[model samples]
Target: MIQHFFLLLSIQFRSFFGAVANEWENNRLKLIAGAVTLLVMAGAFFFMFRGLFRYLASLDADLFGFGTALASRLFGMALLAFGVFVGVSSLITGNSALYRSERSTLLMAMPVRRSSLAASSVLQSWFNAGWTMLLMGYPILIAFAEGLEFTTVYLSRGLLLYPLLLLVWLSAGTLLTVLLGWAGGPSGWKLFGGIALIAGCGAVVFFAGGTSSDLIIQEAPGMQLGGLQNFVSDLPGQSRGYWPHSLFLQAMVKGNGNAALILTVEAVVLAAAALTAASWKFLEAWNRSAVAEVRYRSPMFFKDGGRYSTVFQKDLLMFMRDPVQWSQLGLLTGMFAIYVINLGRFPMDFTNPYWLAVGVFINISFSAFAVATMMVRFAFPAPSMEAPGLHVLIQLPRGRELFYGSKWSQTLFLSVIPASILAWFSTMSIGAGPLLQVESVGCIFITAFTLSTINISTGCLFMRKEAGSAVSISSGQGGIISAFASVGFVLFMVGVLSWVTKKYMTDNFTELMLAKPVRDSILYLMLPVGFTVSIASFRAGIKNLRERVF
Candidate 1:
C-alpha cells in the first residue's frame, strides 16, 4: 500500500512540474510578469515588516514591555491566521481532489488500494494549498531576521519549522474533510460549514460587543498603554491553544530544542493517524459522496426575455451551481460584518469633525479595497468561466458583445450595491456629516465602476479557456496585473481624497460643523481620472474581444 501511494504521489508531482515547465516555455513573458508581480508584493511586505520590527527593537519596553514574549505573541497570531487559511484551502481542495473531480473517479476505477488513492488525494490537496505560502513565508522570515538582527541560526530554525507547521495544519484539515465526508457526505458538509461559519461570526460579534463597551468606557478618557498591554498579555495565553504554532515559535525563535523535537513528533504522529483513519473509512466516505446529489432551485426573477437574457440566466446558473463561489463570498461577508461591528465599537470622539472625517475616509478606503478584491476573485473569471458554453455563445447574434456585456453588467451591478451599503453604514457608524457621507459613497461608487471595468477588461484580455477553475484563472499572471492596477488606483484616490478632505475640513471647520459643503468639486478631481481609466480599459477589452472572438 505504501509503495503504491508513493508511486501515485511521484506521478502527480512529475505531472505538476512538467506542466509548470511547459508554462514557462510557452509563456515566458506572462510567467516573468507574474513572478515580478509576486516579487514586488513580497518586497513591499518585507520592507513593511522590517520597518515595524526596527521600531519595536528601538523601543525601551521592547514592544510594549513584552520583549520576546510579545514577538512570540505576534508570530503566534500570524501562524494562527495562516493555519485557518490553510485549513480552509485544504478542506475545499481536498473535497475536490479526493471525491468530486473526474480524475478522482478515474483513479477509483483503477486496480489500486483505496487507501493509496485517499492518501494521494490528501497529499495533493496539501501541496496545492500550501505551496503558495512559501513565497509569503520566506519574506517574513528574512524580514524578521534582518529587522531584529537575528543570527543565521534563528533564520535557519524558522525556515525549517514553517513547513513542518504547515504539514500539521494540512493533516488536521484533511482529517476534518475525511470525517465530515464519512459522517454527513459532501452536501451535508457544505451545509454544516455554512451554518458553522455564520454561527462562529455571530459568536465573535457577541463576545466582542459584550467586552468592547466596558473597554470603550474605560479608555474614553484617552487611549492608554495599559489596555494595550493587557490585550497583548492575553494573546500569548490565547495563542497557546494552537499548540503547533506556539511550539513552532518557541522552537524557532527561542531556540528550544525540546519544543522542536516535540513539534516534529506531533506532526509525524498526527499525519500517520490521519493516514490510518483515511485508510479505514475514507473509501466508504468516497463512495457515499460519489452518489450524493445536490438540488438547487434557480431564482424565479431571471425571466427577462431580452436578446441576452439567456446569457444572463446561464451565467447566474453557473455561479449558483458552484458552491465554492458562494461559500467564499459568504465567508467574506461574515468577516466584513465582524470588521464593521468592531469599527463601530471603537471609542471615536465623533464630535471632532477632523477625526470624523478621517474615520469616514478610512471606511471608504477599506470599502474600495474590498470592492477591488471582489472584482479580482469573482468578476475577473466571468468571461473565462464561459468556456464550456463558448461554442453556443459564438453562434448567437452579436454573441461576443452580448457575452462581454452580460458579464460586465452583472459584475458592475453586483459590485456597486454592496460598496454603497458598506460605505453608508460605516460612515453612519462613525457619525460623519451628510455631505461627507455622500462624498464617501460617491467615492466608493467610482471605485466600483473603475475597478469593475479594469477587471472585466483584463479578464477578457487574459482569458484562459482550458483552465480548470476560476481560482486558477484569477491567480494567474493577468489577475496579478489586475490586482496591482486596482490597488494602485485605490491608493492614488485615497491619497488625493485624504489631502482634499483634510484641507477642506481644516479650512471650513466651523461651516463643516454646521453640515455644509466645503467645496464645489468635480469629485475632488477624481471623476476625470476615473472616466479616463474606464474608457481605456473598455477600449482594451473591446479590442481584445474583437481579435479573439471575431
Candidate 2:
C-alpha cells in the first residue's frame, strides 16, 4: 500500500511535467522566445540591483557601517515580504491543485488514500509558486552577498536554508487550505472574507496616507557604524522569543551555523506540522468542496452569476464572483495603495520645472508597467479560462472574437481605468500644468492599450487546456511569454518616451541642438507606431486563431 501511494504521487508529478513538456515540444519557438526573454529580464534585474548596491556602498555617508547595516535591513525586509508573497502564492496554487485541477476528480475516484493525493498536491503547489520566489529573490540575494567570502557558513545558505524555508512556507499555505475546507468554508464566508479584506486594505491605506513619508524613513533610526565596534553596536538588537531579525540575518546572510541550525529546526517543525494536519484533513476538505451544496455555492447563494450576462458582462461577473480571482487583484491593488498612501514622501520640487517633468515621467512609466503586469495575469490566461467549454465556444459563429473582445473590454475597465487614475495623481504630484498632465494621461493610455492588445493575442496563441488560478497560469509557459514579451515592449516604449520627454515635454529642445519641430515630429511618430502595431498584432492573432484554432 505504501509503495502504491508513492507511485501515485510520482505519477501526479510525471503527469504535470509531461503536460508542460508536451506543450514545450509542440511550441518550441514560442517557449524558446519566452525563455530567452525571461533570461534577459533576469539579467537586467540583477545588474540593476548590483549597481544600486554598489552605489549605496560607495556613498559618502559612513553611518550605519557604511551601508552594510542598511543593506542588512533591506534584505531582512525582502525576506519577510517574499515570505508573505510565497505564502499567498502558494495558497492560490494549493486551491487550484485541490479543487480546480482536472486530475482531482479522476484521482479521487480511484481507491487512493487521501494522504497520497494531499502529499502530491502540496509538492505541486510548492513547485508552482515556490520556484518563482527563488527565481526572483536569488539575484538580489547574490548581489548583496558581494563582499562576503565563500565560507562554509555562507555556502550553507546557498545549499540548504533557503529551500527549507520556502518549503515550510509553502506547506503553511496548503495547511491553511485544508483547515478552511475542514471548517465548511466558502459560501457566505467568501463574501465576508472579501469585504473584510477590502476594509483592511482601506485602513492600511488610510494609515499610510496619513503618515508622512519622511517620518517613515526617519523612524527606522540607524546607528552610525564605521568599524568593528560600530558593527557590533549597530547589530539588530536581541528581543524576547527572537532577536528581532538577528537570527534570520545570521542564518541567511551571515551564515552562522547555530542560526542555521535554529532555522533548520524551525523549518522542519513547521513543515512536519503542516503536512500532518493537511494529510488528516484533506479528504474532508475535498468532500466538502464539491459534495456539500453550501460549499459549492458562493456567498450570495441566490443566483447563478453566469445567468445574468452572456458575453462581456458575463466575464466581468465571473471575475467579480470568484474570490480566487479577486485575491490576486486585491493583492496588487493593496500594494499599489501602499504607494498612494505615501505620495507626499516623494521629493519633487514643483518650482523646478525639470524635476516636475521627471516626476511625471517616472509615475506614468510605473503606472503603465503596473497596468501591463495586471494584463499579463488576467488577460493572458483568458483563453484557457474557456477550457473544456471550447467545444461550446467553437460551435458559435465568431466565438473567438467575442471571447477575446470580452476579455479585452474587461481588462480595460479593470486595469486601464485604475492605471490612468494613478497616473493622473502621479502627474498631480509635481503640480504639472493641466496640459502636461493630460498629455501624460494620453501616453499612459497608449502604453496600456498597446500592452493589453499584445497580451490578448499572446494569450490566445499559447492557451493551455488545464484549469489553474491566475497565479499558476502566470507561472506557466504562455503566461511567462506574455509577461516577458510585455515587459520587453514596455521597456522599449519607456526608453523612447524617456527621450521624447527629455526633448519635447520639457521647455526647449531646439536650443539644445535638436529643433522643436524635429522632436515634435519624432514624438508624433510614436503615436502611429503604437496604434499600427496594436492593430497589426490583433489582426495577425485573429487570423492565426481562424487558421489553426478554428
Candidate 3:
C-alpha cells in the first residue's frame, strides 16, 4: 500500500511538472516574465528582511533577545496562516477537480484497497500544499537569515520545522474538506465557511501585527525588557494547546533542543493520525456525493423581449451564475478598497497640487490594473463556457462576428463601465482639480478601452475547456500571462503619463496650472486614439477566432 502510494505521488508530481513545462513552451515570453516577477519579489523580500534584522540588531542586548523571541513567534504564526491559506485553497480546488475526474472509479476497481487509494490522494494533496507553502516560505527564510552563517542548527531546524508546518496546514485542510464534503448541497454553508475562515485569518493577522508593533516599541530606549521576557515566557504555557505554531517557533529559537524535538515529533504524529482518519472516512462520501449533477433552469422568458436584448440578458445572467466570476470581481473590489484606505492614510499637504495629482494617478492606475485583470479572467472565459452550445449559435442566421460583438458589448457594459466609474470617482475623491479631473476622465476611458481589447484578445487566443470543475491556479498559464501583460501595459502607460506630467510641471508649472483647458484638451486627445486602437485589436481577435477550431 505504501509503495503504491509513493508510486502514485511520483506520477502526480511528474504530471504537474509536465503541465508547467508545456505551458512554458507555449508561452515562453510570459513564463520568462513570471520568472522576472519572482526575482523582483525575492529582492523585495530580501531588502525587507535586511531592514528588519538591522533594526533588531541595533537594539540593546536585553531588548534584542526579547524581540528575537517575539519575532520568532510572530513568524511562526505567519507560517501557520500561509499554510492554512495554501492548504484550504488547494484542497478545495483539487478535490473539486478530482471529484469530477472520478479517478477513484479506476482506482477503486484495482486490486488495492480503498484505504490505500485515499492515502495516495491525501499524499498528493500534501505535495500540493507543501509546494505552495515552499514557494512563499523559502524566499522568506532566505531573506530572514541574510548574511548569516549556514549553521547545522539553522538547516536542521528549518528542515524539521517547515515539514511540521506543512503537516499542520495539510491536516487542517483535509479535516475541513471532509467535514464540508459531508454537508452536501450548495447551501449557504460554503459561503459561510469561506467568510469565517477569512475573518479568522484576518483576526490572527491583526493580532500578530499588533504584537509586532508592541515588540518594536519595547525596543525603544530606556524601556525595560523584563516585561517583554515575562510575556514571552507566559506565551509558551498559554499556547500549549496550539502546538503547531508554538513548536515551530521553539525549533527556530532553540534549534534541535530536546523540547523542540519532542514537539516536532508530536506535531508530525498528530498530523499523520488526523490525515489517515479523514482520508478513510471522507473518500467514500466524496466519491458518492461529488458526481451529482446540478441543473440550473432559467425562468420563462417574456414573449416581447427583443433578441439582442435577450442575448445581453443571457450573458449577464450566466456571468452572475458562475461563482468564479463573482469571486474575481470581489477580489478586485477588495484590492481597490485597500488601495483607497492606504491612500487616505497618507499625510499629504493639500497645498501642493502635484501630490494630489500623483495620488489620483496612482489610484487610477491601480483601478485600471484591477479592472483589466478581472476582465481577462472572467470575460475571456465566456466563449469557452459556450462549449458544445457554440455549435448551435454558429448555425444561426447571424455570423459569428455578430455573436462576438454582442459578447464584447456585454463585457463593455458590465465590466468596463463600472470600472471606469470607480476609477473616476476615486480620482475625484482624492481632490483633483478641473484639469486633473478632465485628465482623470480621459485616463479612465483609455484604460477601459485597453482592458476590453486585451480581454477580447485573450478570449480569442485561449480555448477554454470544461475541466469538469472549479478553476485551479495550476490549470492554465493563459490567465496568468494575460494578467501579467495587463499589469505591464498599465505600468507602461502610467509611467509615460507620470513623465509627461512631471515635464509639464518642470517646464511651465505656472502656465500649465493657469491654462487648465489647454492641458485638459491635450489629455483628452489620447482618448480617441486609444479607443480606435482598442477597437481594431478586438476586431483582429475576432478574425483570429474565426480561423481557430474553437
TM-score of each: 0.85, 0.76, 0.68
lDDT of 2 by residue, 398-480 (tens): 77666677666766676667777777776776566665666567667777888778888887787767765565666677777
After superposition, candidate 3 runs with Cα above 4 Å error: 1-4, 7-88, 109-111, 126-171, 185-192, 203-208, 211-274, 291-295, 300-308, 316-321, 324-328, 331-358, 428-441, 465-475, 500-529, 532-536
Better of 2 and 3 by TM-score: 2
Pick by lDDT: 2 or 3, better one: 2
Q: Global lDDT of each model?
A: 0.72, 0.63, 0.58
How does model 2 score by TM-score? Answer: 0.76
Ranking by lDDT: 1, 2, 3
| TM-score head-to-head 1 vs 3, winner | 1
Give the better candidate number (1 or 2) by lDDT: 1
Q: Looking at model 2, report the run of 10 residues with the lowest lDDT sum.
A: 209-218
Q: Flag regions of model 1 displaced more than 4 Å.
A: 55-77, 149-153, 188-239, 243-246, 250-266, 297-299, 347-358, 504-524
- State the TM-score for model 1: 0.85
Instruction: Give the residue spans of candidate 2 off by over 4 A.
Output: 1-5, 13-45, 60-78, 99-112, 147-159, 186-248, 255-258, 292-310, 345-361, 387-400, 429-436, 465-469, 500-526
lDDT of 3: 0.58
